[model samples]
Structure formats: C-alpha cells, structure tokens
Target: MRFKSLRKSNQVFIFAALLFAGLYYGAGLLVPLTFAVFFAALVLPVIYWLEKKTGIGKPFSSFLGTLLIFIGIGILLFFFVQQLGVFLQDIIESKDQIISYLRKVQLKAADVTGFSLQEQNKLLEESIMELLNMTQTYVSGILTGITGLVLNFLLVLILMFLVLLNRDKFEKFLMMYIKPERQEETKEVIQEARKVAYKYLWGRLQVMTILAALYLVLFTAYDLRHTGLLILFGALITIIPYIGPFISGTLPILFLIIFGGTVEEIISFTILIAIVQLIESYVLEPIIIGSEVEQSPLFIILAIILGGMLWGPAGFILFVPIFSMLKIVFDHTKGLEPVGYLLGNERPGSKENLMEKIKRKIGRKN
Candidate 1:
C-alpha cells in the first residue's frame, strides 16, 4: 500500500510538470486567456451589481462592464503613448547634455581607478554602443509584433465578456463535476478563492492610487519636468514586487540627471522617494492591504521570478494573485494542504513559533 501511494504521488508530480510545460510553450494563447480570466474575476462584482441595480439580463450587464473596462484601458493607453512621445522628444533634444554627463562620469571613474582618460572614454563609448544596439533590437521586435498584440488584446476582451456572461454556468458546471459528498467543500473553496482575488485586487488598486498621489505631489513640489508622466511610471512600476521600487526610482533619477537637474535636487528627490517607500511599505500596506494573502516571502519571490520568465512584466504583476488563489485551493483540497502550508507565511504559532512558545512556557513553569 505504501509503494502504491508513492507511485500515485509520482504520477501526480509528473502530470503537474507536464501541465506547466504546456502552459509555458503555449503562452501565446494562455497569456491572454489567463489575463481575461483574472480581469473577469476582478470585475465580477461590478457585473453582478449592474445586473441587479438595473434589472438587466446578464448578457447586457456583462457587455456593459466589459465595454467600460475597454474604455478605461483605451484612455490609459492614450495618455501613456502621449507621455512617451513627449519624453522621447525631450531625450532627443538632450542628447548633447547626456553625452557631456557621461563624459564627466567617465573622467571621475578614471581618476578614481587610475585608468587613462582615453581608455575610460573608449570603454564608455563601447558601453553606449551596446546599450543603443539593445534598444534598437527591442524596438524592432515590438514593431514587428504590433499586429499580433492587437489581435491578442481583442481576444482577451472577447474572452472576458464571455466569461462574465457565463460565470454562473461555469460555477454550476464545476460544482456538478465534483463528487456529491465533496460538492460543498468545493463550493467553499471557490468562494474563498474569489474573496482572496477580490480583496487583493481592490487593496492593490487603493495602494496604487495612494502612491500615485504621493508621487505626484512630491514631483510637483520638486518642480520636476514631466511630473505627471513620472508619477504615472512610478505608480505603475511599483505594482511589481521587491525590485520594482528601485527601477521606478532609478528611472526618474536618470531622467533628472539627463535633463540638467542639480546634484542637490537629485539627492533630495532620492531621499524623498526612500521615505515615501518606507511609509507605503509600513503604514499604507498594513492599513489598506492587510494580510489578505499570506504567502511566504520566499514563495512570493520565487513566483515573481518564475512569472517573469514565463510572461514578462504582466506575469510579474499577475502571478502573485494567481498563486494566492492556487494556495487557497490547495489548502481546501485533500492531499494538498501540506503544499499549501509550504507556500504560506510563517505566522504566529506556526510549528517553529509553537516550539519556541513551548520552551518559554516550560522555563516559566520551572
């Protein structure tokens, strides 16, 4: 019986590996579908509310919700593109200033390292060339895929609409497929997953709004050029975990240096950003997001890395919620609770904590 159980466990592992391989290889299809599903989940409450509030059928409400989402996305894209154009124009005009700054930095480095200025200049030139090559390659790749990107976006919209429309049916189907005895547990798991997704997404939106306001006010007070654009970029990038703040902070600093910001201004802005980040991490996150999804820090980091490898930036943002939902499911399902615990945060009274508490209690008793 033990051998049979081991064999079954191996089969499950192999099956899971194969499923992940398929998802990776078929990302062109899966990425959009995954996005659509998540979006549908996020907006499901809106769809239901509209249906009840207006006495409209599911189809009309779903369509209305999807259309609203599309309009919002369109407006966001328009603003992003407009800001990007202006930023690019500024960069083009500042080329000479950028070159001068690079030369100054190169000279300082040469003095510190005792390398000849000529060698330093040569190294800087090579680095710039490599960076330009990379930028050109990335732009060319994006241009080549513009048509496919549009089609995939359209597909996501359609899928989101359909999913929202048939959401009840889908839930029913899932419940019906489960064994009769387990149906209630399965329903409970599904409800918990929805709660997790809804709370996390809503909390994140609140956090982003607060961050954007903070950034906008700070940037404006500092008299930064392109204040709105910088705030937008900073707020959007902060959605990615751990490394996102560094990237967001670095971009604005680079922009300032190239656009003739004073050293004091740069330092002051950096300090402001660091202070705001600390506030966000400690005050805002706790007050707003709370501990909605209690995945461990290690698991969260691994999920971010794996997500970036699979689906680029979008994956980085989406994977946290996705994994949290999976963790919820694992916690509810038989034979999967151990895996769920492994993914969970080390909370108070966890095994390690419990053992420590026991030791302390015994000492007190003695």
Candidate 2:
C-alpha cells in the first residue's frame, strides 16, 4: 500500500510539471490571442445591450463591435504616426540647437565634474552614429514586426467572431468535463473570470487614455516640441506597466534638452509626469482594481516583475489574467484553498508602512 501510494504521488507530480511546461509554452504563443479575448470580454456587455435594444443578432453585433475596435485603433495609430513624423521633423529642424545645447552641457559638466569636451564630443559623436546605424538596421526589423502585427490582428478578429458565433457551445464545452455536482462552482468561476477580465482591460484602457491626454495638455502648455507625438507615446507605453512610464517620459525630456528648451519647460514636463503617475497609482489604480481580481498585492507586483524579466512588456500585460485563472483552479481544489487565499491581493490603505504592507500582502492566512 505504501509503495502504491508513493508511485501515485510521483505520477501526479510528473503530470503537474508537464502541464506547467505546456501552459507556459502555450501562453507565449497565445499572448495576442489572450489580448483579443480580454477585449472581447470588455465589449460583450455592449454587444448584448445593442442586441437587446435594436434586435441585432449576436454575430452582427460582434462584427460591429470588432469594427468599432478597429476604427478606434485606426484613429490612435494615425495620431501616433502623425506625431512621430512631426517629432522627427522637429528633430531635424533643431539640429543646430541640439549641438549648441550639447556644447553648453559639456562645458557645465566639465566645470562641475572635470570632464573634457573632446572626450564628451567623441562619446556623443559615437553614440549618434551608432543610433543612425541602429535605425538603418531597424528598417528590416520593422518589416518583420509589421508582418507579425498584421497576422496577430487578423487572428484576433477571427477569434472574436468565432467566440461570438459559438458562445453557447463554448460554455457547454467548458463544463463538459466537470462533474454534475461541481457545475455551479465552475459556472461561478467562469463568471468571475469574465468580470475581472472586463474590469481590468477597461480600467487599464481608461487610465492610459487619461494619462496620455494629460501628457498632451501639459507638453503643449509648456511649449515642448513634438507634444502630440509624446502624448501618443504616453498612451501607448502606459500599457506596459511601470517600465513604460519611464521610457515614454524619457523621450520628451530628450528633445527638450536637445532643443535647449527653457528650464521652465523641462520642469513643467517633470512635474506633469510625477503628478500623472501619482494619480494613476493612488487614485485610478485602486478604484479600478479594488477587490476585483482577487490577487494579492505581492503577486501582482511579482507578476509585473516576472513578466518584465522573462518576456518583457507582453508578460506584464498578460500576467494578471493568467494568475487569476490559476487562482480559480487553486480555489477549486480542496488542499489548495489556503494557498489560493495567500496568493490573492489584500486591500490597500490598511497599513502604515512598506513592511506592514508586505506583511498584510503575505500574511493573509494564519
């Protein structure tokens, strides 16, 4: 009996390990697919409301909603490219100003830090030349990237249509394996998953939009060059979590310093970024994320870190949903319920300091 039990335990462990590997590989391939599904969940209610109010069929409503998503994307892309073009033009126009600013900075740095202009100029020249070379190399890379993007876009569209067309069948398919006694629990998990996914995607979109718009207003107000482009970048990059903000913020600062803009303008841009991040973190984040996904604060931060460490930005975007699904599975299993509760997020503002926050996040159960 002991031998048999040990063998069974080993078999279970092996199966679980294999399952994890499969899931990780599958997730890498289906990040784009996951993105489409997340959006579909968000727009599902709208589709239903439209269908109910106007007598439209589900398929037709799905197509219309997909079209709306495409149209909004088209507009955002148009603005982004337009801004990029204008920013590049401004860069070229301000070439002389940039060189002058470099000379001033070089002089100031030498006075303060005892660096030599010749060395500074040599370093700067090498960097600029390297960037130019990199841009040329990126041309081919861009073509490949564009091809991948088009493929993913079509795939997302197809999935949205199929998911809508066979919604009832899909639900049945999901529940087919579960025992009759557990069907209700399975249904509840599915419902909760859908709600969390919807809240998350929509909340993220709304916050990103607000931050981007705020950037545009502040950049323009400060007379920063390429304000529109930087704003578009702000909107786009905030989708990537913590790292995105730093990058999008750096670009505008670069040209501001490059063009010898007033210290006032630079200061304004800095203040604006600091404020937007604060607002997003403290106000918008809690409001959108509050008690919804059932993820612990530590897990959420770990998701961001691991996503960044492993797969870069794509990981961060997909991390929360992936973990939420895992939590559902864990919740369903008898022995894993305690673990699931620990993996979930604790409420914020219930602590006085960082250590307290960590304790609350980690010490959820006795």
State the lDDT of candidate 1 residue by residue for 1-366, as single tens digits: 999999999999999899878868888777888888877877888887887888999889889878977887677666765676676566556566777887887777878988888987777777775775565566456555656766877899999898888888999988878999998888889888988887777777788789989988887887778777787778777777777777777877776776667779989988888898887776676566666576788988999998888887778988888899999998888899999888888676543333355578999999
What is the TM-score (0 to 1) of candidate 1? 0.87
**Whole-model Cα lDDT per candidate?**
0.79, 0.73
Q: Model 2: per-residue lDDT, tens digit, 42-62?
A: 788888899999999878998
Candidate 2 residue pairs in clash (backbone atoms < 3 Å): 295-344, 295-345, 296-344, 296-345
The residue-level lDDT of candidate 1 at 252 comes to 75
Which one wins on TM-score? Answer: 1
